[model samples]
Each structure stands twice: as C-alpha cells, then as structure tokens.
Target: MTQHVNEFIQQGLRVLDIERAGIDDITPSINQDFAQACELMLNCRGRVVVTGMGKSGHIGNKIAATLASTGTPAFFMHPGEASHGDLGMITATDVVLAMSNSGETSEVISIVPVIKRLGVTLISMTGNPQSTLARAADVHINVAVQTEACPLGLAPTASTTAALVMGDALAVALLHARGFTADDFALSHPGGSLGRRLLLRVSDIMHEGERLPKVRHDAIIKDALLEISRKGLGMTAVVDDNDVLLGIFTDGDLRRILDQQVDVHTTSIASVMTARCITAKPEMLAAEALKLMEDKKINGLVVVNKQQCPVGAFNMHDLLRAGVI
Candidate 1:
C-alpha cells in the first residue's frame, strides 16, 4: 500500500484504541449519578426528551432510540429545533437527557432556561463535570475521558464514546428495573427480524385448514406424495380417521422407500411413515420452534392442538419467509 494509506490506517486504529480506553476509564464512575438518572427516568410520567447539538445530537438520537426500544419512553429533540417550536414536546412530567462533551455546547446550554422553566427533571451526560451543563443539571453523569482519539484532540471521538456508553448504561439499568422482556422489546421494534422471532407464534405462520398437508391413515403412498407436492412443504402428515396424528412421511422417507423398491402405487403411507415425529404446539413461540428444529436436526414441524391432532404444519422455509429465521 501507499505510505499515505498506511498512515491513515494507523491513525484510524489509534483513534479506536483511544475511544475504547475512554469507555474503560468511565466504568467506575457509573455509580450514584447513574442510579439517580435511572430513578429520574423511571419516575417520569411522560417521556424522556433527549437534546444535543451537532455530533452529540446524532449520538443523542441513537441513545433515545435505544431507550425507547428497551422500555423507556424517549425521543430526540434537536436543540436548534427546540429553540424554534419543538420545545412544546417537553412536558413538566417528562425528564430531559442532554448530551454535550464539553458541557458548554452553546446551542444545548442556551435552551436550559426553557427546560428548567418547564419543571422537567434534567440529567446531563458530559465529559467535563465542572462545565455549565453539568452544573445546571439535577443529576450530572460524569462521562469523563482522558483524551480524544483524534490526533489533534479536536474531534469528538473518545468523548462521544464515553457519552454513548453512559447512555446505554442508563437505558439498560431502567430496562431491568422495569422488568422489560424480549417480547416488550420486540413490540417496539416490529420492523426488525428480532421482533418477528419474539412476537410471532407458530399459529401465526403455520399452514392451517386446507393449506395443511395431511393424509388419512388409509392413504396410498401415491396420494400422500401428491398431497405433499400440492402443499409444497416437502412432507405430508399421516393421521387417523379422527384427525389424531399418527406419523409423518417426508421427502427423506420417500428416498429411503424408493431405495428398497417399495412401489409408490401399491404402498400405504402408514406402512412407510415414521411415528413419534417431532412436533410443536400452536401456542409456542416461533423462536422456540427454531431452537427445537436446530436441536432435533429437522426442518419442519406439525403444530398440534391440545388433542395432539395436527392443526397446522410449517417448515423452515415458512419461518425464513416470515422473518422469523
């Protein structure tokens, strides 16, 4: 590589190293004020209004999202916008989380009087405890770092990382205090795959009624094969006259039967089916089904009702397409 490229790479690595060190330095400082911040947010009846400027604003937005998704009600308000008309978003019952590395960001500090006038509890995350923002806050979290990762010590690198970690710490502390579960997190993040895994149940994605691939106990292998092909699930469930599942025959079973030269036209599905097949219930979470599939080394499952009758059937492909994979 060129000398200039090598120098750039070295500088980037140094910056990351410094930022990581900064995060490590603030571990011991996460007491008292951290707890106070969590208490303030937990007691908040309205919402958390996070405000910042420039790069701090970007990090504040992400912090607000993390807090919101993890059970804390939070939203980001750019200081500039708040100065315009967005200050109406804040209520006296809410809590304000302000981010500023130097604790003296003019745009953020300028709005303190309005926030204070609204009687909203204020929590400040700043690298400088003696700075104006920290002194003005009800609870000041000292996210101090030794130095910036920027070689010139002018960029936000290490200071921003310290602030972000502090924000995460507060969110998680509140999340645990509120008994937030994966289901709760999923509810707030419905667009992501994690949401599907936690919120979706087998019944939500399984093929039910006419879509289920099922055959009677007396079904001929040819008829069962046709049902499997028609359903496109690569398997057909074998059940008794009363719809109680007896066994299942999959593409793997057909391959084994064909090796023995068992004629599909003459054979009965029950004769070649494997009983005691793995199954799941409609009430079970889809993520649990995924784990069962992985553990049993199987790709599909029959969803049984309380009577153990096959109410639905689904395969790995169904989960993959449903965003539960």
Candidate 2:
C-alpha cells in the first residue's frame, strides 16, 4: 500500500509539471496573430461562433461561455453538426473560432470551405501551425506543447490544458478591450452570489418598519435590550421624540454595562450607547456595506435617510441570509 501511494503521488506531480510546462511554452503564441484575432472579434457585428471536435469541443464550449459572459456574444457549435444544418448559425458578419489539437481534425476541416464561402473571419487554435486548418485560417494561434502529460502520450492532456489557457487569454483580452465592468458582469450573472453582492442594496435586505429594532433615547437599558431581542438583530437604534437617530446600543454594550454594574431598569439607553455610529444608506451596495462593516469591525448598521432617521436596520446574519456576506 505504501509503495502504491508513493507511485500515485509521483505520477500526479509529474503530470502537473508537464502540464505547467505546456502552458508556459504557449505564452509566446499570444503575439501578432492573437492580437489580430482579438481585433476581428472585438469589431464583429455578430456573435462569435466557436466550433471543435472531441476534447477540443469541450474546451470550446467553455471558451464560448466565458466569451458570452464577458461582453462578447458567442456560442459553441459541434463541428460535426456544422457540416449538417448548423452551418446556418454562422453569418458573414460573425467570426468563427475553431479548435483542433492536430490542426487536421477531419470534421473541423470539412466545414472550412463553407465558412470561407460565407466570408466569415476564421480564427484557428491548433498545436500544428503547418496543418491545413491553421494554414486556411485568417489568424492562427499555436497552442503546441512539448509532450502529453499522460505517460502513454495518447491522451489529450497537456494539449487540452494549453488550449484552455489560450482560450482564457483570448476571453480576458477581449473583455478588457470591450471595457467590461463589474456591473456589466453582474448583469450577466444575476442568479449568482457575485451578482447578489454587487446588485443587491441595503434597502433590499434590511428590516424596516415594524421589523426595525429601535428605542426612544429616554428608554431604559432594559427597554433597549427588549427591542433588540424582539427584532433579533443583536442591536437597537436610540432615537429622540422627533424620530431622529441619536445613538446605537448592542450586545457588546450590554457586556460593558454589566461589568460597570449599571442599573438596566433606570439607566437611559442613550447614556451607554455608541453615538454617531456607523450607518448605511438605503441605496448603498450590499458589497460596499459589507466592506464598511468589515473595516469598522462591527456586525450591524442602522440605515438612515436624508433626514437622519433610522429607516431600517440589519446585522451580519441578515447579510449572510441574503448571500451578501
């Protein structure tokens, strides 16, 4: 068992080392051809149609998704399917990105004449720049690797990794060239946690009205404690008769007051509360509010309006529940 475990570890490391070298070898391929491909895709009037076969098809699908999400409209078409009826998906204004490790995949090469006939810009990513597909493309990116990570040299290991890295390079370069912002990324991923953090506002997740935890400035410490417990936010806002916020009292304050032996029944909540504490605006991004809370070392915040009144309140738990933490 010990000998087998050592063999497994050694083989895993060997694979990783070879794959890393393969990626490093392709770094020089991001040259004039890559820049020209990006220029064509950036100025394309229609979507980018990505096509490949077998292992390259899987990588092409991922590349197309990354492009679509990062401001470039793109989709993957199986090269075999393109020779059937899917060739209709390509247009003269669109750009075609084809991938094949050997640069001679019969299925991919079979459709090149039709793609050229449509006058669509053709970009090829292959390990052999001298092969037919690479020679036929308007732009060719060489993703050649020294050797396969597989000990047998039969599996598509290092070559697929090199292609994946090159695809990422293209996607990120186009993303930057298009000036895609975080807001634009959030718009494309509204159902994901990143979108929730970037798009959700304090007002959307905060407890307002009857759910808000607040007490009068003259209210006793016991009254503030009761309000905090009732609202379940671990804190309460202290406000005057005009409904303007004066201060905030939290569970931490209770601990400090307990050490001082203050009378909870008679002591005014305002006397021991944190005055002018950290606050959030209703329109503030939940991500920004989270940063503020983290920077201030606080777990809760009072949401104030333009009139300095506490309109809502929330705690770390609320952010966690809303997937903003």
Candidate 3:
C-alpha cells in the first residue's frame, strides 16, 4: 500500500523472526539440568514456588499457572514479598523455581539463602548460566537468547519469550509423565469450552420425558409426522410397547414417502422407517456424540439406555447451544 505501512509490516515480521530464532537457540539447554529440574518437581510432594522480579515476575506467573493446569501444582511468589513473610508459603518438601534474565535480580538473590535453609530444592532459569542465582540453585536451566526483538535492545522481548516457552516445555513434559488426560485437564478448566465438550454427556443436553419425539412402531405415518412436528427434532423414533427404539423416521424419509404418494392415513410407520438407526447412549460424551453424527452424515441422534429404550434425543442444534459444537 504505502511506504510507511510497508515499513511497519516489515518491522513486525522482523521482530517475530528474531523471537522465533531466539526460541530455537534454547533447544540445546533441554539437557541434564532441565531433566533434573523436571525430575525434582515431579518427585516433589509439595507445590512448586516460582519467584521473579519485574517482567520475569509476569512470565513466572504465567509459567506457574501453566504448570498447575497441566498437573504440576505450582504458584507464583514475588521474591520481594517472599522475604517479607511470604517465605512461609514454601515448605521443606516444596521446590522453588526462580526466574531472572541476568541471573542476579537482588530481590530474588536475597531470598536464596532462606530457600536453601528451608531445605527446598531450587531451580533457576536465567539468560546467563554463570550468574549468582544459577550457582545458588540446585539445578540451572539456561534460557539465553541471541538477540532481543526490541529495536533498542532495551526491553525483555526475546529473553522473556524464551523463558515462557521453556516453562511450557517443562509443564507439558510433566503432563505427559503423569499420563494426564483431557478429562483431567477438563476438571481443572470446567468453565472453559474444552471442559464443556469433555465433561458434558448426552443425557445432560438431550430432550427427555414428553419432549422426545417418539411413536409406537405400529403407529400410522400421520401420527409419526405429528410427533416429529410437535417435538421439532426433524425426526421421530419408532418404538415398541416397552419403548425400545425399533427404527427412526426422519424428514428425509417423509420426502421419499411423499414422492411415492404413500397414503399417510393407512400406511404403518414401521413399513417405511429406517431400522437399525445409529443411536447414542445416555452416558456417552457429548463430543463423541457429535463425532458420530458427523461421521454418519446425520443431524440428530436418540439416546438409549442399557435396555435399548429411548431415554433422550438431541440434534446438532442442541450441541451448538450447549457449546459442544
């Protein structure tokens, strides 16, 4: 478009490239120290106490959260606050993870002796391995960056990104070590959309009781059509005397029947309904139900109990409203 706009775009992409290359440079440090740090946290019986100063504090906070959500229990502790009585939050069995780009933030360094005295394992992530904090820690993982994304090289850009990605790498490593599943993750994030998809069941959103569009197998086509219209599910389940789902008659079936000019008043629904319809169970995960609907090229499903009796019914619209779609 314009020269100034092109310069702005180029500058943004340049910064991104610098940050990505900085991340790539961090790969070699995922060696012994990193493994030992992960092992220390994994075997720990108590929580991980993460501490930092300034921008590192912000990155440490996010790291702590990622670790907690991924099955490694952790929390952020401001190093300055920790010296002022917050140190009590850490137990002898706990592990302390400290972040400092220079490996020499005074606030974090001042509390190292107390952490050591408490007999807590210390892990340090720093841009300089030879810094004081790294030497004091039981394990040190270098997060050195080759360049800063900042044009003036005065801001915490690439270094902070490296630390954040390192933290995520640690969290996911622990998550896999514990065999953490999506169900476990969902429990920790029940308010999020992922939780809804994993935790919700067919029975939770399905229409049951009188809301179900169902009719006897011997019921006339007109009766089934009335049930479909009343239930508004675009389909009707044909059931036997015990309410076991025998077949399904959908609007598609109605279209075919109309083309044949079948007498609605005289023809039994069982004669034209599609038997052996795909069905879902009441306890089936809502996400799984959606997969079934998609793979079978259908829009709705009937939830049946163990006895093959129709318990509930739902369609894609129901899943959309439930946020499972």
Q: What is the C-alpha RMSD of each candidate to the true structure, in Å?
A: 2.2, 2.1, 2.0
Tens-digit per-residue lDDT, 106-165, candidate 2: 999999999999999999999999999999999999999999998899999999999999
Compose the digit string of candidate 3's lDDT tens values, residues 53-140: 9999999999999999999999999998987899989999899999999999999999999988889999999999999999999999
Show the lowest summed lDDT stretch of 10 residues, model 2: 191-200
Relative to the true structure, how large is the alpha-carbon lDDT of every model?
0.92, 0.95, 0.95
Note the clash tally of each candidate: 0, 0, 0
The deviation in Å at residue 325 for candidate 3 is 3.5
Q: In terms of TM-score, how similar is model 1 to the real structure?
A: 0.91
Candidate 1 regions exceeding 4 Å error are 4-9, 192-194
- What's the ranking of the predictions by TM-score, best on top? 3, 2, 1
Worst lDDT run of 10 residues, candidate 3, spans: 1-10
lDDT order, best first, reads 2, 3, 1
Which residue window of length 10 is worst by lDDT in model 1?
186-195
